[model samples]
Structures are given as structure tokens and as C-alpha cells.
Target: MTMAYKNVIHGLQKDEGTKENLFALVFEQGMSTNAASIKLAIPRSTAYSWVKKEKEQRSAAIEASEIARQTAQAAAAENLKVNLFALVFEQGMSTNAAAFGLGIPPSTAYSWINKEKERRDFTGEASSKTAREISKEDLKENLFAMVFDQGLSTNASAIQLGMPPSTAYNWIKKEKERRDITGEASSKTAQEISKDDLKKNLFALVFEQGMSTNASAIQLGMPPSTAYNWINQERERQSVTAEVTKETVQETVKETLKDNAEETVHETAREISKETSVETSVETSVESEEASTKDADSVYRVTFKL
Candidate 1:
């Protein structure tokens, strides 16, 4: 009957879903061919063919939309809000309020709180260091502790101690082999490789393989500096990793403590009778304590050779 009907007859001679959708939004809705063309952003001829098909299959589109809506609603109820502060500050609710609303746990809320604190304190790496002569054994022990125990990389430790990248790389490479052969747990060894093999492998991965030092450290399961050193040495562009300051670390810790305090405040507030507002303020007054320059535990970065 129309030019549009001719186009639809030719175009959807194949696909059914497009035919059904066109039918539902046009013929069943009693929409004019011009209106359907604008609504579906298609030529009027295609709308006529869809309208003809929709007249034949009216029930299916209604059923599909109903199913989709129900599935979406169910997913929304079950989804956990992993970012607590966003659930709180952005949503204008407290941690307890957000957790209850989102169907998530209190511990998840606390983890997000600490994560937020770490994010806040992550200023670009800048620290002050005092160099001290550490014995080779002690250095080996520290390196082992950093890599294996602490899961840090060499550049991270070098940044903390303010040492040359080459110095950290050389020491770890020497110690890893000695520990492996002696069957001691002090240094981490490469699987089935000599000292020369270790250096060559490290160089190839850093330079030719083109992996970043941190990524190489994770792949090699060693420290960051070891990987960084090999790459730097091969390229002849030795760049020192900037340090993160004690002050920055302390600030991060303080923010964490503050979040803990807020959680405690929230827990206490939740216990008070909700039927009637009972304003009870419990203040924890601790006297001023001396601030120390050092961290509670020493943090070292380990470098991994690829």
C-alpha cells in the first residue's frame, strides 16, 4: 500500500527480531507510518513491513520486556557496593546506612575505608633517607624479608633507603643463587639457572622482552629493583625511584585510625534506641603522645629480575 511497505518487504525478508520489534512499536501501538519512521529512526517502508509482522506476533515483545525488567531488578538487589565511601559520601549516608541499604557486610565497609585512606595519602614518591652501612648478611636477610616475606620489589626498597638502583640489583642477584644452592631459605633462587644465566635472563626480559620492572618482578616472583636494575643497566639509563616519605606513611596511618574512630562512633550510635532520639556522646580523651620519625615497622622494597 506504501513505499515504506515495499522497503520492509524487501529488507526483512530474513531477520525475525527486527521484524517483531518494528511490528510492536508500530502496528500494536497504533502509531502512524510517519510516527513509526521517526520513533524507530528507520525508513517508512521498513516500518510498514515490521507493522505487518507485529500484527502477526503481538504477545512476544511484551513477554521479553517483562522478563528483562525482572532480571534487572533481581541483580540490583543482590549486587554489593564495594566502594564504601562512594556509597556513603556520594550517597549522603553513613557506612552502616549504606551497608544496610546495599545488602553488603560491615567488614567490606571497613576495607573500603582503609583503601580510601591509602588513596588519599598516595602523593608522588618523595622521601628523606639516612644511609647506614648494612652488613652483606643483614642485607641478604632484609632482601629476603622484603621479597619473600613482605612481597616488595627492589625499587620500592631502594626508594625507601635512597640507594642507587645498581647497588640493590647486584646484591640480590648474588644472594639468590647462594641461598638456593645452600638449601637455605634466606634468599630466593631462580629455578634451574646459574648466576650468569640469571643476569642474561634478567637482561633479556627487561630489555628485549620489554616488561616493566614491577611487572617483571611479579612474573619472576622477585623484587622490583632487581628487574629495574637489569633493564636500566641494559639501556644505560639508570633512573632512581623516588622515595615515599615517613610523614606520608604516618599520615596514611592516621587517616586509617580516624576511619576506625568513625566506625566505632557509628557502631555506638546504631545501638541507641531508634524509637526515641537518645543523644549520648562518649569521648575518648588520650593525652598527647610524642611523634616519632620512624615507622612502627620498617618497610623495604624488593626488586625482581626478570
Candidate 2:
């Protein structure tokens, strides 16, 4: 036998000192531990412990007598505190509460409860089935996966999952923009937003061409306000249109000056024609006077000569 067993056996040995101590007591005469405990000043617990040591020779015998009796009595209990299911249905205990009382695994208890529900369903006992609640984390993960992996539209996902289309779109848009609650851009948003080819094309057509927001919206099949917002956002990116408004203004001014110069030339030509006509009239008058004077002089000379 092991050392512990030997020690226990040794402790059970009858001892003269214990007997004498018991005899000195008022009650401990010939009686066993229980009777001696009643009569003697020594404690009944001490007396019983002594007897237990003495009875070590009959180890199995003592155990078979009291321990077995108690064990059997406990086993004979009729109700025996039913398991989680019975407690839940018959005693109205919650699954969690029942699980706690029974020391069974909570998951197991919950499974049992669910099984009970399924049974009720099969039997047409329960009126309706409740949908399992979705958590925020679950929604975030699913939305991310749907957008990235499945290539599903946000509105489509919302329709499928019975969520608000706007909410789904907002989540996707926010993630694409990388605008975190902290006002910082996340890498995921930057990547997703960049991947939107439609957005890129739309911005190019709108801001680059100076296309009106409504026209751009019609082309892109989006709201005008949305197109306007995207045009503003395009400005944040590299310059959409290379030629500035200053260059256009300068070109327009140059054309205007050229037109004005041509009109001025036409007016100057008309004034020159009018001045030429007046000069011709003065020359003709002078010519006529000179001719008459010449004729008179000639006549006078002829008379003198004669």
C-alpha cells in the first residue's frame, strides 16, 4: 500500500492513552464513539475520529455502512432537479439560468433550448419563428465582403439583406472615402474610392469640359447635386482642365480689338474720299482764272505791236 494508506491505517489503531483519556471523562465508559461523546467531556468528534482510526481494519466496512447509505438515499430522490430543458419548459427557468444551476455548458444548454424550439416548430406548436439578430460587427464584415469580394452594389445588398439602401450606400461611400469618425482617411477608403472608374470618368467629363452639372448628371445617370459635388471633389485632385480662364479672356479681348481696328479703317477710308473731292473743286477754279488772265494779256500785246 502507498504511504498515505499506511498512515491512515496506523491512525486507526486502538490506543491506551485515548482509552484512558476517555475513561477519565464522565460519560465515556464502555460506549462507542457516539455514546462516549454523550457522556464524556471529550468532544464527540474526537471520539468518532478515534473510532474511525480503530475501524481502519474494516475500511471498506465503514464506507459500506454510512457512506453507501447516504449515497443511496440521495439517489432515491424522485424529482432530482430536472435538466435545463425541463427547467425551462416545466419550471419556467431561462436557458442561461438553468445552465448555471445545472453546471452544464451554456452552449450545450442553449443548443438544447434551440432544439426544443425546433421541435415546437415541427409540431406546429409555436406560432412564428424569429429571425436571428444581426450585430454591427457582422454587418460591417458582410458589407465589406459584398463590396470587395462579391462585387455587389450597395443597394442590391441592402435589398437582399432587408437593410436601408441609403444606409448601405452611406457605409460603402464612407469606407470608400476613407473618412473615419476621427476625420482621418483610412487606407481602405482610399483604395475603394480610387477603384471606382465611373466616378473618375464622371469627374473628368464634368469639370474638365466645363459641362453643366445637370448635363453631367444626365450623362452619368446620377443626381445633379451629386455630380456637382463630384466636380468640386475633382478640383481637389490634379487640375482637371489645363487651360485657365485667364487665357480664354485674353483671346476674346484680342479678337474684339481686331474687329474694332477693321471698323476704324473703313471710317478713315470714307473721310479720305470726301477730302479728295473738295481738293479737285479748288484746282478747277484756279485753272479757269489763269486761262482768262492769259487771254487778256495776249490781246493787249497784239494791239501795241500793230
Clashes of each: 21, 3
lDDT of 1 at 231: 64
lDDT against the true structure, per candidate, is: 0.58, 0.65
Superposed Cα RMSD, model 1: 41.2
Over 4 Å off, model 1: 1-71, 74-151, 154-220, 223-226, 230-306
Query: Tens-digit lDDT track for model 2 on 177-269?
Result: 664666655345433564376577676776688777788767865556656776777675545343556677789999999989998999899
Leading candidate by lDDT: 2
Instruction: Provide the lDDT at 297 for model 1.
Output: 24
* Runs of candidate 2 exceeding 4 Å displacement: 1-244, 294-306
**Model 2, C-alpha of 184: deviation from truth (Å):** 37
